[model samples]
Target: MVPPLVLDIDGTMTRPDDSVDPRFFDVLPQWDAPVVIATGKSFPYPVSLCHFMHIEQNVIAENGGVVLSGEQVTTNGDGEAARRVAEEYVAAGHDIGWGQTDLTNRWRETEIAVARDQPLGPLEELAAEHGLEVVDTGFAYHVKSPRIEKGLGLKSLAPLLDRTPEEFAAVGDSENDVSTFGVAGESYAVANADAKAQRAADVVLEESYSEGTLSVLEDLRERA
Candidate 1:
């Protein structure tokens, strides 16, 4: 059987331009098992992707701070605390960079996201002071509780899907994906993956971006 899949969105499923490849809209819905979108993005992003793709709403969002499986939702981390840290970061004179109407975090429930262009050192310092942690997803830096991570999200979601963490295949291309890679039975990092992700994955594909994700799915189909 083709195992269920957990995928990171930004650098993994997106094209070089950052838009999701249209091919996935055609493919993912037809997969034999569930496809869970795991990312550091806010809840609405992945949930919306599933909605538009005509797939089930299985997601691990906010870098594992929130999870959704059908009607079941589980939340971890402390969004309030993360928000405090971000406020302190701003007080320290750094811009969160998304501006006042920042939709990047508008619907987020368990963590705060900062634009990648901002300095990481200050964000890290502020987060540590608040007993929170900062994770770089290649797309943004997230402030969240240290205990929350995509691996934990997978563990929480697995039982709900009547599967084990080891029954899922994971694919990604950044530091934020490392935890999920460690928990998945099989993991793939796209050719453009950072060193951390490449080290964590079982295989590093030659193709980059969504092309690499397609390669992973194709290989899984053959194995099945």
Candidate 2:
């Protein structure tokens, strides 16, 4: 069986300020099953949670874009198509940026981060000429890599975890979490999620991000 829940960080587990819900920490320890953090966030954020939560399992970072199973690291270059799309936007000069994530907390000075960055600028025109869509991740704008977003990321990790589509769940509250929601057994979005997220979620949280993390996980606890 796969881990019961795959939690998306950022807008799901924490607020836009990068704070994890204390309530989640308060209650997660009592659960007996494994917690796999599935996120578009870099490695450091999830790593900190894993250490503090005493969680030991595979982590899917980079929006399910990268898989870290213990010491192993596998990133799907599938974002290549998406990268090209993003570059088109950059080339067009509309102000889009991408490559990798650099979000972090000052307290966790040396957290592990995945996703690399490329130079930005003069690409927006490129995207416009090509008529491609650019995905905005709050911190940066992703032009296009592939259909290889979060859902594909999860699909990549499925075999390694030995889980089917119906056995695992994904939870989040933002645009980056959409692809994950597409493939999760059960999907949820936090109350703070934007319209796009609301459309994708199977359930929406009543609690804010702080409490939402716990509430979302509590749903997982029921399955656990």
| RMSD values, in order shown | 0.9, 6.0
Q: Could you estimate the TM-score for every candidate?
A: 0.98, 0.70
Q: Write the per-residue lDDT of candidate 2 for residues 20-116, one digit (tens) a residue.
A: 7666675656655445777655556677787787666567765555676667667655444444554444465433322234233121111122122
Winning model by TM-score: 1
CA lDDT for candidate 2: 0.60
Candidate lDDT scores, in order, read: 0.93, 0.60
Model 1 worst lDDT window (10 residues): 77-86
Candidate 1: list runs displaced more than 4 Å. Answer: none
Collision count of model 1:
0
| Model 1 lDDT at residue 104 | 92
